[model samples]
Target chain A: MATVKWPHFFHFSAPHSVVNTPAHRPDTRRSKSYGRSCVEPPSLFWQTPGHLTTLGHRIPTSRRAAKSHNITTKVDPEQVALLIKNEWKLSHVTPLYRFRHTQLKLYSKHLAAFIIAEKQQGVAVEVGVEAGFKVTFSAVLGIAETKEDAETVFIQVHSKPLFSADTPKAVWRGWLTCVNGDPEYLRSLPPDFVSLPLFCSSGPEYLTALVKSWFERTFDCSFGSLYLNSTMLNWLAALWTGCHPTSNIRYLKLAWNMPSQPPLDIAYTVNPQDAWELWNSIHTEDSTDDRINIEEVQLFMNGLEIHFFRHFKIYLSAGTLTKVSTALGSAHHDGKIKIGSSDYITTLLTLLTECALMKTPV
Target chain B: MDEQARAILQRVIRKIPNKKLQTALRAWDHLSSEQLESLDYAQPKWLFLENLISRCEENRLSLKDVTKLEMAYYIDNPSKGTWHAYQLFQAEGDAVSVNFTQFREQLKAHLKDVVRHVSVRTKKLEDGAVWIRIAWGDNFSKPNHLKPTYVVHYLQTSYVFVLNLMSKHKPFLYQALLLSTRHVSIKEAQLSSRSLTAMRDLLMRQYQQVFPTNQERTLKERNAPPSHPSIEKEHAECAERRHQMACEAFGDGVLPKLETAVYKLETKYRGNSNNTLNDKDELFRGVVMFSSSNLLESFRHCVSAGMAEGPVTPLLSSITQKGRNSFVITDKVPGAASQTPAHKA
Candidate 1:
């Protein structure tokens, strides 16, 4: 069965000799390292569960020469174009549309890997004080397979920074067409353009609006937890995609929805002097000698204002990350963290007092 | 010749789809009478029949499977096959029990349906071993147009193995530990209890190398540690080094909060599996804080450092040179609103 000259019947069309061609049967050579000699290279064609005929044989055809024969019978080019245009419009305008319509592409494998890893890590949802209230945003970065399929690219829709030299070139090429719609301009780009770290902002005004809404929803009632709205979550996911080389916090102030009573917004801001004193005292309180648990370090750092030194410490410490990210994602999406905890309320008030005092001392 | 064999052949041939039947018939017709005569033995005929049935099954399995084309592209690439072959050699030395034939036949049998599954498919065998099939390809086209080059089979955590029929060593092993950019935790891979420690240690080494803690750098800077550094010492050293690196990378006067932006980028670079830059180069390349004071100087530092490395320099310089123009600032809202009539509503 192994010696059957079966592959001879189906000649590979390529003029160049490929190793898989019947003419070149795999040899019985020993690898220098493996120490295992080939008994018989497994037959490319194998016996089926029930014997019938050999498969995987190729027929010779010069694809270049015969390519024209495969073309579909022509319709009017204008009509074809119009049909495609109408189809695209129908898909995009459909109320049930889930995928975004855009020409930009992203790294497919990287995007897949990122999404899988991120979902496992889970997005952190924090319903806490920043300017008013802050929730971590996520973004999707996608790779457009084709112009028609761009609608189905992994629909991460907001703009943030993507940090990596390994970012695929196709992503930038498609993005150039999406944003500029100029072929000449895309051609003008340097060969290495797509590999650069990219940052796309929804702009200061838009980000502030997102925060304002986040604050409004959280303050609507004293609650157990506040889940992030789907709209904001979607916006965050879009912005975070394809953008990396990031900071510990990418924050926007919610001055638009500042609570007028008690001027709580003013207290939210951290006084660096006070924050440092708190941090030092935590370590030195009982004795000069103090050993901190990794968990406490994380909690302490999470409570620090974005302006505080503890913010940088969180990222640099053995890749140690707090539940802050998880807390944020969960508080917004899963509604797990209870707001009734005295510790949480105190922290919130402390943050508010810091902001309020920083503005106009009580 | 045998009654039972002939009956079985007839039954199997009936299962072949019309498209595959055509292929089998065409292949049969292409064979000369002498060649046909050579396949008179029951064994050869049996092999032929089996091949036909397998082909039909493959066609059915691949139907509507979006990622098949992409997988084929990777499988067909000779260079990638050889590279994986080398990797398997290093990882599997006598430890892996499955020979090439058993692994190949099992993979070929299940690959079709597994590739088409909607969610990522991971199957743990009865023997307490786990295997996952990940489809990999560039975003050139959708899963259908381009054949995927490789369907990576990560076996436990000890090895990532593949059998490339395309390689010169057809049906040989390829190891992919150093080559693959995708980093799934060893625990996620679910290794045998015995190999777990070894694999975890190997992964830890790789992780630490990529994301050297400040303690690791400081200890290296000192040439030697006075003793085994405690966890607190390590954290403290790391924190101090981080502060110094932040000041040097950004500026002394930069806000600690603002400085974190650069630190975060460094941490990200550290965490990334694909970055090829050394620690020093990473410092320059990864510190991407957009300081108002002198963004260009920082970018210039990256380019100059990046030039020492050949591959990353172009990418580093490209972002630096084109950074300003890359982002487009567009209005989020329309200038005016048009209200449709209540009748339409």
Candidate 2:
């Protein structure tokens, strides 16, 4: 129910109306070319220093030495225009274009807000040698709830060092409440107020760097475990090529303390609860007391391990290895697990009973 | 558990001939408990007759009434029955009584001969023929050309032998006639031996037609030619181009224009403030602007109601002096020595 806090001043309804109407309607007098002639180019208005210098105050660009930080880039008018044109074209034909368009707009609005805010702060910026204004997309650390006493925090950029003068006094006073805040509750505050980068002119590589910087900030703030949503996986995949992002984050679900509930039929794969129970029965109580190494057992239960571990947190431990050798029936050895021409029906039945059990307990 | 099943079992066990009793018992033992219970024990004679008939019928052997009546007599009253006429003049030996082995062998020979004589055979269909055929219609229009229906010639005879419609099921019919002939005589069985060879030859021909001569090519490949790789590639390229065109037309063309308009409108409205607008003034202005245009009414109303905007929390601030240069009084934090790199391995 909680909606994103988009800027009220920048009304984005014009595009929505344009999309709602027929694209090639000759009867209606609405500007079919998306008001290209109505609005002046960014070059004309943005060049006026006094009017636009406020954008720098909100986003301090190129604060570090030029060689150390190559982050000062400005948004281009033509590119944005092209981006808009592409979105408009897709909206009419593609089935998913509408949804994608909405997401793009949301992201762009955030980016635009940052640009406006940074400019208002009256800070000086060194536009990079690579020409045109571009912004570094800020990582969303967490969403904060608006309590009565607590003031709403804008897109916060974390500062290094705890108990520093730059750390906001309100953060030390325990005013902010982020939804994705670390459970350990570190006291160090996010010191910088940053603008969201709307356009990624430098590609995802630069975005990856920005993300890495955010991670460093987050880690500096808290020495405890950091919990990230699964959506981060998709973001990382988009940012980096050939580098498997999931590999870096160790599976740490054991600390989550998930709620105990019956598995729903909505899941496409095997039921985790059934798999857990089956594991318990097959391995015996004593064997289960220690952590089950996923690599140690060569069971051919497709997706069983993933399903169980995903839902519930199980700690990995270096303990005595107990193998469920009977169920496997001598097919796989060591790490090499290959499915052979075994009795398919029997194997299916075994998986059904142990992993994907549909029967509810009496 | 039922009396009928028990009676049927007893009758089957007792009536089975001595030579083949062991084999019959073994086959019976393989039956599940449910199958055992389903026997018609009330009419044991009929059950024996049916079982024999089923066995012969399975081999696609057309039978005469004389054969059935004789077979029924032999099964029901095994002690009173004499050796069949076909067995009387066998070159190898004559038998006083018909045993399961001799009866089965003779029956197979006779049925094969009968089928070869009665059934009609035609040249291999070029387009191919399906196993089943009725009135031609859309539902059953074109027979699957992939499946070649090979025929075994059989002689038409006026024999009152009852049978279910099982001509389509060649394999089952073939097996039934071969294993369960009771009334057929040795003379009749011997006379049809030549016809049996012809039946065997027909079956061999059908098998050859069904299977591909070459071993490597799978049935799927044999039935239809493999799709060309170029065609698949072209199809994929076409889809990609279509998507690209769509995105270019809408996303790049129209969407950005609308966004620019929105940005322009925001700047236009905010410029009218003259640095004197309070929260109330801004709210009133927003409401008026929204009322005039349908685009921003929801946003204006939502903001006025305090449904979205919360109290402002400034994380950091710097002051810009009126007369002198702007001084950053807020950058007081000591910098860290170990800065995390922009990219880490």
Q: Give the TM-scores of the predictions, in the order they appear.
A: 0.20, 0.14
DockQ of 1: 0.01
lDDT digits (tens) for residues B131-222 of candidate 1: 33343222352232221223244343344433222332122112223223122221112111112222223332321222234534654675
Score each candidate by Cα lDDT.
0.26, 0.23
Question: What is the fnat value (0 to 1) for candidate 1?
Answer: 0.00
lDDT of 2 at A38: 34
Per-residue alpha-carbon lDDT of candidate 2 for residues B77-178, written as tens digits (9 for 90 to 100): 323311110111212222324444454454445444434422211221222211111111123243221122222212111011111223353443343333
lDDT tens per residue, model 2, A286-360: 332332222212221212323222221111111111111111121111111111112121221122111111111
Candidate 1 residue-wise lDDT, A133-227, digit = tens: 11222222221112221111212223222454342321110011121111222232222122111111122433323322322232221101123
